[model samples]
Target chain A: MIEIKSLVKCFGPTRAVDGLTASFSNGIIGLVGQNGAGKSTLLRLIAGVYHPDEGEVLVDGIPANDAAAKAKVFFLSDDPYTPKGADVEGTLDFYLGLFDIDVDNYHRIIKAFGLPTKRAVATFSKGMKRQVFIALALAMKAEHLLLDEAFDGLDPLIIDAIKSEIISAAEHGKTVVISSHNIFALQRLVDRFVIVSKGHVAREGNNEDIGTEFVKFQAVFSSPINEENIASLGFRVISFRKVGSVHHVVLLGNNESIEAVQKAFNPVFIEHVPLDPQEIVALEMMLAKKDQKGGEEDA
Target chain B: MLKHYISWQIRKWWPMLLIFSIILTVTALYTNAFTTMAVRYYDNGSEYVPYYSFGSTTSNMPSLFIVGLVLSLVMSLFVFSYRTRRQSVDVFYQAAYAPTTIKRVRLLIGLAILLLSMLIAFLLGTTVFLLRYVSTPAEEIKNNIKFVRISVHWGMYFLSFFLTFIFVGLHYLINCFLVSLGDYTFDQICLLIFGNIFLALCFTSPVIYFDAALMKHGVLNDYMWYPALYSLGPVGPVALVTTTMEQAIFQRDVAGDFAVNAVVSSSIYALGGIGALAFNLFVPDPSGEHADQAGARNQAVAMIPHGAAAVLGMLMAALGLINDVSVLALSILPIFGFILFSVVYYALLALWRHSFRMKKFDLICYVSVVGGTLVMLTFAMAL
Candidate 1:
């Protein structure tokens, strides 16, 4: 179990991770955010790569920066470090010297992934490099695995293989926290989603709850209704658009708000649209942006 | 864990170490052979007889001092290079060992390599010298030689070797400390060069200024500068070694006075090395966040050379005034020096921030440096 409490990290004037609080225990948690949304910063903070300017991170009841805690966690960065002129065997020896890894599993994964043990990792393709590091992370058998951009350049086949490996690791009681922009891939792998925006958790829950919270609707109205009317009708609008007098809106309220939207619009036809995991995350990000703009105006 | 780390480092760095050792051995052999040939001469006694004068074994090992200095610097820079890159830092600093342990192991291994290389050269040079000279007929050479003064005994050889090791150790320790203050390889190299020169100037400039003041009073003697030159920061040990070697070459009794001087200077340098070691181990590792961000890791340490140069500039201005230079020249000298130092300072700051547009903090630091320099100038002029 890794627990982050009120973590705040800053790079000069820019606050990268601002008061972010989250916990992971024995399951795959997907960290979904846009570019520069502090997901990488948060992962580094938990990995103890960067000391937090404020707050603390604990892994299995020990401070994350502690060597004992670090031993239990393996952080595979987006661009993992392989020393110059290091072949697969050399790289493995380097990591194996530092951490206790399952040698059998490491060799098995290397063979399964078809990574040449004698070839320099620097000569490998982008996906191959990612596989090398992912294999090492899995072989480490650490209690917590923090992977940044875990599936960035992987092909569909390798992605499925890695996804299955992550699932097996999670099933064995390893807490896996992955930060990636591949929401579609994440939807299949992760048991929970933590949507991040502006360095904080905008929304976090299991897949079922996260998907149901932001309800999407397509409606046709007799009279034109702006976004303000929808909000006034008590449907917390995430996004509202009009195409040829047909209203399409995503709202973040309960079933009552759905009814209120139907009653207020008195639509000629209204239909509830189911949001996929990607659509839910997009709506959450849109809502976050709106709130940010509104707060800036108020300030 | 430390054993494994040492083995890994040795494997990575053995090529460089082997090359350095080879260079040292070749140089040592050449220097010894050259000195031996230079001392062997034909004396005009009856018929021309070949005479050999082995004055000092210590002076034959100049390669130890010169090559050891190069090895010290190169090893220090490369040994701590992991601290200069984010990728390297991520790999090394995230190891399952404490940061202090990592640093300690690296320092020990660096020192081990340095000492090992020097020992190889030293032993090889000594063996060659013994084979060529010690087995020769000593009585016959002494009778034929007119200037056969072997002033440096075996004990002096031991003393010289011990002091040389201390000198090289101090150089490596201080170099490592300077390297730790930077966040990039170029910055680290700049700091190593600039920091040593600045420290050397800081120690020597005051004595030069004082000598100029005394000269103005007509109380200066040539020998009066010797005591003042005895503690020239990193340069002090070099001067001590050269002076001792000179004394030995001249057949002077170096045991009484020069040995005391060498011991005192080496002690001071040892103290300095200790301080560097303390700073190197105790400063917080900025980790991957500050890697490759020159001057961002330790602002206070980065400002040290600027601060020292500022004060040294004032002392030079004072030295000019006492030397009876024109009043106008004296006034322009410090202003010119200040501008030159400021340009260098700003250039380094630009490299650190990767921007020419100075931040408010940078401006404030510049102003503080200028203010501190002015206050020091005032105190000196008042005195």
Candidate 2:
């Protein structure tokens, strides 16, 4: 288990991270935030690279800063910290030396990442570099591992490779924390998400909760659809478009409303358009903004 | 693999190594030419060398040799540092865990090679000094040996070579300060020169002043004050000498070689080393949020305040020429200012600029500041 207690980091007058408090118990956890939302800062604080200006971090009920606490946690960075001018062999030697990592495990993970074990990671492409870091995290096999922007810039195959590794790590009972803007990608891997906006944890629950409670419906009709009829169907009117005989309507709500609209509209073509991950991300951000506004109004 | 890391360091230095070798060869030839000229000149009626004087009240060769030594030493430091810092900090330090004793051993071995290079350079510097003012072609074997013996100890630059390592190593350790100015290449040169000049001035100022302390101790005690020069290991007050700020934190009575107690001043260099260690030991975990890269604050700052950066640089150089006591200590003063400026102003500008979109000129501003600071400190201290 890992815990963040009111963690804060400030850059000049602006806060990069603000009063973040959360805990993860044995599972795959997803952290999501927009650019500059302090997601990486939170991860770095946990990794012990940057000390929090306020509050503390704990590992398994012990101070995270302690030597004993650090041994169980491994943090993989968004951008791999490859030794400059170091070839692949030199980098492996370095990590193996620092972590006292076993050669068999290291090589196995290296092979798993599909990187030539002998080539310098510096020479590898950005995606390949991320793979190397992921490989190291898996090999460390620590009780807890943290990763930032774990999916950005990765090809689909590499992403799947990493996704599988996360699954495997979780299967082995090691807690994992991953952050990404790609909600759908995250939805597939993370059991739950901690949505960060304006430097605070705005939401916490399973992806299913967000998926089921907040849904998007798309219906196409051969006949022209009137706005009044769409309104009569009783679904929030997100948007509508017409192309010759085909009329399209998009709605957001629960399954019952969607089913009722499906029966009443009697559309020729009905499609449950999976909500864009970014759109859901935007919706969550709106919730955060609303929360802030509510707090301001109260104050 | 650790061996590869060390070799990479050495390879980075290869060009500068070649430069140092060339300088060493030239100095050696000069040393040989001058010493031979000194011997040959006295046997002839007139001197064979350009500036021949036998028993002058004030000597010229010591000054020349000191300048040559300082020049060569500073140059080698430049080469060593450029090669060392070219790699990102993460890569080099990642190798620290390579093996027990590997890091320290590599450092000591690197130091040895540097020491040998300095020794070769100093020998040539000595011969250059020896031939500067010769009388006849051959002054006789015994006469030349005696002359060489009296002034030749300055040729023992190897003694102070340890000091060079301490200073250069501290430069590597305190890369934060180096990175702050935002100009890695010029910033490093600035760092090496500023540090070397500060210590060199501290150690040599008293000698140039012919201060009362040295007058009372005589030339020999003056040598004692210079632990590196006297072949004395820093063990007590003698040990007060250091290359970094760490010594001052502990209040060690470091023996200052030139002006102030060298031991005390070396503490400033030690301070830098400790800072470097602290930074690496407490690396932050970014946890894969993925939008971040290592702080390129300098790159960000390079956009604003190019001229003020220039002035601050000028001020740093001015501090360099002050007496050894001041030079050794004051060299870092600008460093503190640079860090403070970066910490304070970077944030202000960052917030104001908030998604601070940077242009090329903005980046140039910081590079100028970094490069200019180094040049400023170097010449300013000379004054």
Candidate 3:
């Protein structure tokens, strides 16, 4: 378990993660956000790579930066570091020497991933290197695994293999927190979602809930409805677009808002589209941007 | 595990190790061949004379040792830089080991490699000496070659190892501190250039000027005091090494005073290493962007006073040198003056940082204290 209390991490004048308070238990939690959205920073803080400027990150009630706390966690960064001349086998040995990894599990992961044991990792493709790191992380058998951009540059087959490994690790009661922009991949793997925007958690809850709450709707009206009429609806509109008489809008509200839009517009036809983790994140960012614009106009 | 890690690090450093080893082997062979040729040419009886040394005899081993030490230390910068390069920080720092432990491991590996290189060079140099002089016929040795003075020969050897180790440690400490200041490559380059310049100035023969001035005045204190003062800078260690060799190997009585100066010089280096280590600890590790901001924001407040103190000390020392005053005594004064000025300057910077206001009386007192010291020094010089 990890408890982040009012965590704030800054890089120069820019706040990477600001006053973020959250907690995670044993599960695969997906952190989804756009570029510079503080997902990586938050992961780094929990992993104890960067000390928080304010508040704290606690791992099982121990301070995250504590050696004891770090012992239970393994952070595999997006661009994994391997020495210039390091072979896959050498890199494995280097890390295994530090952590008491399960030898059988390590060998199993190596065989499953089909990574070359002798070739230098520097010569491997980016995806292959990422797989090697994934293998190493799995082998560690740490209580918590924090992976940044875990799915980048991986093929579908490799992704599936790595995803199953992560799921197995989670099933064994280890806490896995992964930060990535690949929402579809995460949607398949993670049960919980933490959506970050501009250094704060824009939304956080069960992954299914985030997907269900934010609905994408397409409606066609006989007569064009003005923008004000669409705004008057008591729902947060994430994206608003119109082609001829058809309006394509993504909204955040309960089922009542969907009904209200149907009743108000009395459209020729209305269709509700299912939302994914990516759509939820895009909608949240849109809402945050709208709020910022609204405040600026008021000022 | 530590041994495994060290061995892995050694493999990484194989290229540098090989280069140094080759240099040592070649230099040793050349020295022996040169000595044999010199023995044949200087066949005035069978004296075992060294070709390299003139009246003041000493082998080039001490110089070569210093070269190897410096090269090894320089090579370490590359190895250390790789530890923090790009994504390596995340990999290393987030490992099961603590950050300090990782740093310690790197230092140990670096020091061990440097020691290995030094030992290799020492052994090669010793082999050349033994083969060229000790193995030769006794009659031939006695006729042309005078045996090296045990004290000078052994002292040089000891100084080479001692000074090189201290220097490598000091160099490591400085790099560790400086790398935290900014961009790693930029900081390393700036430090290297700055260090070279500082060393050049230190070795610029401030002692030579003082020695000449004293020698011209027929001062009896010329031999010991002037050399000791000169040994205060970077040249001090080099002088200490060479002088010890000169006294013990060449059997020069005049070198005894120099050997004393060399001891003082070695102490200064030891003190310097301690100071660098203290400062290295004082500076926080360059972990996050916070340190970068803080370092940049406080650059003037932190660095200006120290820079001012150094420049002022140099000016005062130059004045002492130009006035042909007591160089030994004056050299000591500049060091004390540097400390005093640095303390005062730093206190003022602290006040400025805190926006502390001084009363008119307090301001007057500070000015008087600073001005009074200069005035008193000038008065003393006039007297």
**Residue range with the least summed lDDT across 10 consecutive positions in model 3 chain A:** A92-101
lDDT of 2 by residue, A1-299 (tens): 78899988887688888999999888898888788778877876676545577988888887665545656677666765676666656776556544535467667777777787667778888888888777777777468888878888777888888898789879988899998876656757888878898788987777667534455555676566776777776655445666666555555566676677668868777766676555666677666766777898999
Give the TM-score of each candidate: 0.88, 0.55, 0.76
Worst 10 residues of 3 chain B by lDDT: B288-297
- The worst-scoring run of ten residues by lDDT in candidate 1 chain A lies at A207-216
DockQ ranking from best candidate downward: 1, 3, 2
User: DockQ for each of the predicted structures, in order?
Assistant: 0.59, 0.10, 0.36
Interface RMSD of each: 1.7, 7.1, 2.5
Q: lDDT of each prediction vs. the true structure?
A: 0.75, 0.54, 0.64
User: Cα lDDT of model 3 overall?
Assistant: 0.64
lDDT by residue for model 1 over B86-180, one digit each (tens)?
Answer: 87777666776776667777887788888887888878887887776655443445457544333235765666666677788888998888787
| Per-residue C-alpha lDDT of model 3 across residues A202-295, encoded as one tens digit per residue | 7788866765666677888877775578678766677788887778887766667768988998889888877666667667666766775787
How displaced is residue B59 in candidate 1, in Å? 1.6
**DockQ of candidate 1 relative to the true structure:** 0.59
Task: Residues B1-383, candidate 3: write the lDDT tens digits.
Answer: 44655565566667766676677657545554554333222445778444433312134544554565466447546545644354766666666555566556665566566556656766776666565565654443456855442222354455555665465555555444444333345344444443433433453344544454455556636352444333324455555555564554556665666666566765765566566556544543445333212112344323433333343444454444444555555444744664576466546534433435544544554455456446534533443
Identify the leading candidate in terms of lDDT. Answer: 1
